[model samples]
Structure formats: C-alpha cells, structure tokens
Target: MRAKHNVLLVTNDHVSTLTGMADNTITVSALDRTKVKINGQEGVGRDLSLHAVATGKEYVHETSKDDLWFFFDVEVASNPALAGVAGFTTFVMILFIISYWNSAGSSTALVLVALQILCFFCINPYLIALSDWRNFMTEEAEALMHSSVGMNKALKSVLTLIVLLTISIFAFLMLKSVLPDRSIQDMGDWELWVAMLFDSASLTLPFICFGLYTSLPLQVVQILASFPFLFMIFFSTTFSPGAGLEGVKGLRFLFARFYLWCVIPGVMEGMEDCPKDNLTLYTVLSGCLGLFLFLGLQGVLYVVEMNKANAAAADFKALQGSDEFKQLQVEMKYVHTDGTPRGFGQTGVDYKDGYEATATEDSTITVSGGAEPPANEL
Candidate 1:
C-alpha cells in the first residue's frame, strides 16, 4: 500500500531551505542481482544526483487548515444544471403555493409545501449530499431495502390526509393558464364546474406517476419525477413542520421513510422530553419551509425561462428585419440596374445610375418631414 501525504505548508518568506541527506552529503550505492536472472544480466546500478537552489531573502512559515464549506458550496454552485433546476423548482413552488395565502382556507398541504421549501434553503449540504448519493448509488446494484409499491401506497395515504393540497396547486396553475377575467361578478355554475374539473385534471398525480412508469423513455425520469416530492420531504425536515404535520402525514410511505428514519431521529435528539406540539410544529414548519424554497426557486426559473424565450423571439424578429437579410433578399432578385427587369448582364451604366439615384432619393426621405432641398440649390 502506498502512503498518502497530508502536507500543509504556508510561507511568508522569500527564501527557505530544507534538506534531507546522509551526513549532509550526496552518495549512491548499487547491488548485484545475477543470482535470480536466467539471462545472467546484472540489474544493479548507482547514480548520484546533486540538487541546489539559491534564495535572495528569508521568510516565515505557518501551517493552516482549509475551510471545508468553501469547497462544498463551490461544488453545489458549479454544476449549472443542478443549480438551475433546483433554483427554478424552488422558485416556482414558492410563488404558486404561497403567493395566494390571503385567499380561501390555507390547507395543511400548502403550509407543508411552503415549510419544505424553507427547509431546502437551510439544508443545502444535505440536499447536495443526497443528490450525489443517488447518482453514486445508481451506478451500482445493491440490496433493495425498500419496495416501490409500498412507497407509493404510503405516499397515497399521506397525500389523502392533507386537505385541498392538490386542489390548490392545480387551481393555481390552471388560473395562470386560463387568466380569468377580474370583472366577472361571479362564476356561473358551469364555469365553476369546468374550473374544478380542470383543477382536478391538473392535480391528478396518477397520470404523472403512470407516465413515469410507462411513457417516459428517459432513464432519469423516475429521479426527476421524485424530485418535487423529495424536495418537499427535505424542506419539511429542515424548517418548522408545525402547521404542516397533517401534510407530512399525508406524504406517501416511501417518501416519508427518510423523515421517519433520519429527520425524526435528528429532531428527537434535539428535543429531549419535548411536548407533542413541538414535534408537530417541527415537522410541519420544516416541511413547509423546504417546499416554499423549492417552489420559490422554480418561480424564478419560470420567469428566467420566459425571459429567455422572449429574448430569443425578439432576436429572431430582429434578424428577420435586419439590413443583412434585406440585402440578401435584394441580391437574390438579381434585378438589372435598369428600371426595366432584365437578365444579369444586360444593364448599362445609365441603368446603374438610375437605380443608384432612386435608392438615394428613397434613403433621404423622412416620415415626419419630407426630404429637404439640395444644399447647393438652397
């Protein structure tokens, strides 16, 4: 086994010398190995080497420790895809879930989602570590400690416990999609039914889950699909999970396993002989915070993507009307300089003169004020 070195050196000096040699002198030795060679070739030799350096000044040195957080943050921010995806998800969830807190009865699920978002912001390292762990674990096959079906059942049960959680999320998105008129005094019975139907359709997770199981061709679909819910889990664990306990209780079993195995244990460790409210509060608040953070990030991402799309459209429009494109169009026509349309080589200088004169005249006209008289004539 080769030994690894953990060397920490710091110097505030211009010159320093450290040497390790026998008797402070260089020497060499050789050994003969004819005893084990079938070819009878001797395999021992000696070489003497001298190394020297001159320094102009003296300096001091000290050993210092490196901050680990700097590297961790660097790794997190350096991955463009991860940062963008995480940030966007956080933004969108926050905006969608919490932006309308003033209206209607805020459900346990929304509160939980908001708490989860808060958690995500707080548990930055844990999120990164978990992400890395998944990537690493995917490369190797291991014993299945848990079942997917069981996890799904647990999730369904948990989600069922939370009131109007799905409806709110779906309704928020549907409203955005439909942009309802504010002047309407009230929704007609049919309109309300239609909106509810739309919300129900939007909130339907079966299709998304089924898509994950059936339609999605990508290898990472499962991972991506789990991203939103897992982030909720992460947030719940991090922030105050008080108001969101019912929501956490609603999380499917497989997703809740981590909270049961890890987050609960940590929280328990922190709170010795604590009351039930503390537990509820911790769970709900933590979850809501994480959800909020994730959605908030997602909202920002939506705006960013929208802006990018707009900018791209504007650029395309600009290119379409650009001078270069117009020039290309004119060149393609190959209209002879003469006013009369003719083949490429048929035009004379008189034709060229007329074309140039017309072009100049057209160029000089202003919309607000027509072309001025020639300076010499004025």
Candidate 2:
C-alpha cells in the first residue's frame, strides 16, 4: 500500500505535476524523469512529459486517456488481496486440473476450471486495480472517466446477477441429488424459478459489495443460511408433488427448470452426462453469458455517455498564458500541504507587503493564484 505514496502529487496522461510537503520543507524533484530536462526547470517542471523516466522508475502514470477511463479509478479501488489469492489458487488448481483435465473424471477437473473462469471474469478489474495511480486525474478526463465508471458498475451488477443465477441453478441440482428418487424433470414448471432468481441475487450481494465490503466468515454465514431455503424448495416439491404447479400457469409455463438445470450453450442440454454431478459446461456458459451481456450493454452506454462527456470535456483544458499567473511568479511565498491545494478563494488577499506568508481573517492562504496555481511554463 505504501508503495505508491507521494508518487504523483498530480498527473494526467499528457502531463505530470509535482508539489511539496508544505512550506517548502522538502525539495521535491521529478527529474522530469528524463535525462533531457527542458526549460531549465529540469527536475521541477510544471508539466513533464509522462513517458520521461527518472531513477529507473517509469514516470508516466498512465499512457493514454482511454486507460484513465477504461481502467484506472474504478478498478484500482478493488481489494488487492483478490489478485494474489486468485492467482495462487488458480495456479495450483490449474496444475492439478492439468493432470486430470481430459479424464472422464474430468468433472473433478472443474474445480480449477471454475476458479479460472471466475478469475477471467475478474481479470479486467484486477488489472484496473493494479493500474491505480495516486495522481489527480484531470477534469478533462472526468467525462469519459465517469462514463466508464458508471458503465462498469452497471455491467458488474448484471454480470454478478448472471453468474449467481447460473451457480444457483447448479447448486439446486446438487441439492436435488440428496434425495433418493427426485428427478428435476418431474419438478416440471415450478413456480419457484422467480424465487430462485431472487435468492440467487441475494447470494450475490457479497460479490457486488466486493470492494465496498468484505468479510469472509460473514459471507459464508449468509450463504449457509440460504441452503435451508434452497433445500426446502426441493423438499416441499418432493412431498406435495403438485405444489410446484400453480393455477395461473402463466409465467410458470414460460420459465423452465430445464433452462436452469440444463441448456449449456456449447454443450449438451440438461447435462445428461452427469445429472448427479456439477457440470463444468454450466459454469462455462454462465461466465460466457455474463461477458456477452455486459459487453452488449456496455457498448451502447459507452457511446451515449462518452458522447456527452466528450462534448463537455473540451472546456476542461488548462488555460493558456493568463496574466494573473504572471503576478504569482514575482511576489508569493507559499507553502504546500502534502502537494495538494488547501482551498480555492474567489477574491484577492489583503496581505501586507514583504510578508513571507500571510493568512487573512478567513484563514485562507493568500497565494498568488487561487487553488489552481495557473499553469507554469516549464
């Protein structure tokens, strides 16, 4: 976590800005991260080229505006532990599955295979989190950034739902296997499909809240609590037989347990090969459908939201050669607060001449410029 501290101060794909630890206590240098320093400012250039390198570390926070939107802010905030745990688990499971991947008992191979599927689903988010930068993303990038963020949220929500529905269906089959003589086919058109979707959605709340909240034991408890209800759905149907059916026969006819229990897109339907075992095909189809649905909706939303953001984004660029910025060069002795602006004031300051630093009665620092120190020529 400390690896990225004090890294940016501020940056965008086009430029990098370095500030200070207030009152000029520490002299910060960027080296422009380049051997060829421009403008004599060299180490302290106001807007350094992003690709410039210093001290062997890469200076650019991100290479393009697309990355700032497509990956940075939203994904970077996700739990870091996920990558390590997922990687190690996937690695070991993969090795084990490789040994048995082609065996008829390959159903057992589904363990790592399922995890790898989940890992792939997590890939972009993990990369985004890894790409997290400490710099301030420009307001110019905000429109596209915000759009990307919103679209990701909606996408993950839908994806989380799809996977949960698929897994819940599989879990239901496992529950049914517990009974000696139950056949999912006999359940026919259970009015319970609607309930199953909701239950599955509830189970998904943990993943939906992945970065927002994480408590493994609590999550396990929540899932364990659902098992009774899941089992009860089959148990009741087993006893009453006719209870799974209802008088209206409306959506029940439209909703098929076969869709939930079977219907793997690229594989056989109803999982005829292994009715009693978990189907790898189901897991694969679930992940695939989730990706398809997310990409489909995300494409539409990106066009719409990005168009609006792009239109508004033009005005967010830094102003060129304002006279007010010229004055700050001559007569301001200001301090920084960890390289971030303290406040933005709308009016001029009444500082006495020759004062090293002055604060008005309002307690705001009277810097030559407001919170936005006008862009300086390197």
* Model 1: how far residue 360 lies from native, Å: 48
Cα lDDT tens digits for candidate 1, 335-375: 32232333333222222233322322222211223356565
Question: Which 10-residue span in candidate 1 carries the lowest summed lDDT?
Answer: 47-56
Q: In model 2, where do residues sit more than 4 Å from their true spots? A: 1-79, 98-102, 105-152, 155-378
Give all TM-scores, in the order shown.
0.21, 0.26
Q: Compared with the true structure, what per-residue lDDT tens digits does model 2 show for residues 1-378?
A: 012323323345312111111211122455433333323333433332221211132223334465445543454346354445456545644454455333332232233224323433433243223112211223233433333333444544554455445544543443233322223233332322333343233223333443212222434534543443344345323222234445422222111222233322222232333233333334333324323444576688779999988765443233213332222222122212223322222222222222232221212233453354323311
Error of 2 at 340 (Å): 39
Model 2 RMSD vs true structure: 17.5
Give the number of colliding residue pairs in candidate 2. Answer: 3
Worst 10 residues of 2 by lDDT: 16-25
Model 1 stretches with alpha carbons more than 4 Å out: 1-218, 224-281, 287-290, 323-378
Could you say which candidate leads in TM-score? 2
